[model samples]
Target: MLNIDGASKRGSTAGCGGLLRNSSGIGSGASLVTWISVMPTLQSSGESLIYGLTFAYDRGFKRIVLHVDSNVVVHTLQSDRDHSVVGWRFIQEIRRLLVMNWEVQICHSYRESNACVDALANLGCDHEPGMRVYEQYPTSLSSLLLADVMGITTPKVTSL
Candidate 1:
């Protein structure tokens, strides 16, 4: 299973991150985090999703279950036809990758339920523009990863 996420500050930097977990919700020790610099949040999200999928394919993963928090990105990917003008290239690339004889299922997840990758995305924003491939789990993500593996849910708070 893969949980992917993207982060951006409107007038600052942007980045994307993803985590590949096994059935037990433990990191497979293969993860991605990168800074894109100066892009809209939506673009960052789409790019991250694309990067995650491509990474999985390159690693010879034939059956993948992708979890993302952006509804727009998820909807665009699920459509058989593309109607995006801003992210046309990414949409096209994702389509091409999806047809590579793999069983890929993309699903929507709430942000709170996806804390590990979210933390990674924020970490990307603090770094220079580049990508990092990790073979071992980052120490920072240990607690959040544990929560996910234990099925712990974070309570949501809303402002009045």
Candidate 2:
């Protein structure tokens, strides 16, 4: 289980993607890749996380390790109080999801290390708004997925 990523372009579109991997670091054939209409990036990010958790729960996964690229979202999940009124409902939902008996851990991940899902998220931005579930890695994302599985790091340059 991994935290899903949501990408949005200038408020025009929002997309999200997530992958589930076994302890061996190989894909577990449970992945969610899709996009929705324009929405705030934070909202999309939160929604995607919830979506992933829900899927895990429905599938009877008792242990899950989720990774997200947004520190704000991670912090919110760890905090006892909600910070954003706009995201209050989502925050509550996340808290409820966490209350289950399942053992779940959520952590932050750098975008560079999460390139595979990032590319899938970008793919969502280019397509129509809907959800697409993948039992196995999609052919379109093979290169990036392979790199992630191989633990190959690509240079990441960020502008301040």
Candidate 3:
């Protein structure tokens, strides 16, 4: 399963982070960031999705379940009807990846359900531009990772 999240300090920095667990659940992941000082929030997420898909395919994984937190990204991917040129580009690339000989399931994951990726995305901004893969996760992620395996959840608060 690939659980991912993208984040941007709108116009300053942007990054994507996710964990890809093997069939038996062993894990590896990447925190790829762009130093671009003026990227949109949506585009960063879209780019993150692209990176995630390519990483999975490169590792020769044949079955994948992609869980993402952005509803716009998820809806656009599933429907392939995005109107913006940038969005169209991202969607097109992702579509090409999906049509490969693998079985991939894409779903929308709520922010609370994706706390690890959220933290990773934030931490990702600290990385120099480019993708960094981990055989072992960063020590900072220990608690979140443990919480994931234990199914411990954090509360979500919304301002009215």
Candidate 4:
């Protein structure tokens, strides 16, 4: 599944971050790509969210499970509401983009559980013109190391 989130510098954080998890296999073969964007502030709007989603889609992600802390974005995208503002043009674009064999689900997640993305976001906020990417095995020890660097506790290692 592909999970996406954003961070902003002005809001006690740096920028926006996104994580894409490839869970198409079992055990150690899983791959993940994490993306971080450094922006001036968090823009919880359709345009920014669409920008992130489109980036993932353009990169060949088919099935996506999006996680965001923005109620404005979640509600706007999930609800059947009328869009009359020009800014919401992106919302319309997002709706159109949904029909392209890509299943999109947006939900809310607590900030604490979203630490990796949070760190990426903060990194973006702290470093101007910031961007970072990690391609790794989500179930491997190195994945745990990457998670640790993000301040997330590594899961208990279990042997098969």
Residue-wise C-alpha lDDT for candidate 3, range 1-160, written one tens digit per residue: 8887778764668877877786555332332211111233446687777788888888888999999987877777778466567667778888998999999999998999888788777777666677877667778878887787777888888999
lDDT: worst 10-residue window of model 4: 23-32
State the weakest 10-residue window (summed lDDT) of model 3.
31-40
Segments in model 3 whose C-alpha atoms lie over 4 Å from true places: 26-42
> What TM-score should be assigned to candidate 1?
0.84
Q: Tens digits of per-residue lDDT for model 1 on 59-137?
A: 7778999999988878888988777588898888888888898999989998988888888888877777777776666
Ten residues in a row with the worst lDDT in model 2? 29-38
Candidate rank order under TM-score: 1, 3, 2, 4
> What are the TM-scores, per candidate, against the unseen true structure?
0.84, 0.84, 0.84, 0.65
Query: After aligning candidate 2 to the native by TM-score, how far in Å is the CA of 15 from where it should be?
Result: 1.1
Stretches off by above 4 angstroms in model 4 are 10-14, 24-30, 40-48, 82-90, 136-160
Name the lDDT of candidate 2: 0.73
Off by over 4 Å in 2: 27-42, 156-160
lDDT of 4 by residue, 1-160 (tens): 4445555545644466566665542123345566556645435235335656777788888877877766666677787995457546667887887777788877876655555555555555665555566565223235533553455653444599
- Residue pairs in collision within model 2: 3-67
lDDT pick, better of 1 and 2: 1
State each model's CA lDDT, in order.
0.76, 0.73, 0.74, 0.59
- For candidate 1, the lDDT comes to 0.76
The better candidate by lDDT, 3 or 4, is 3
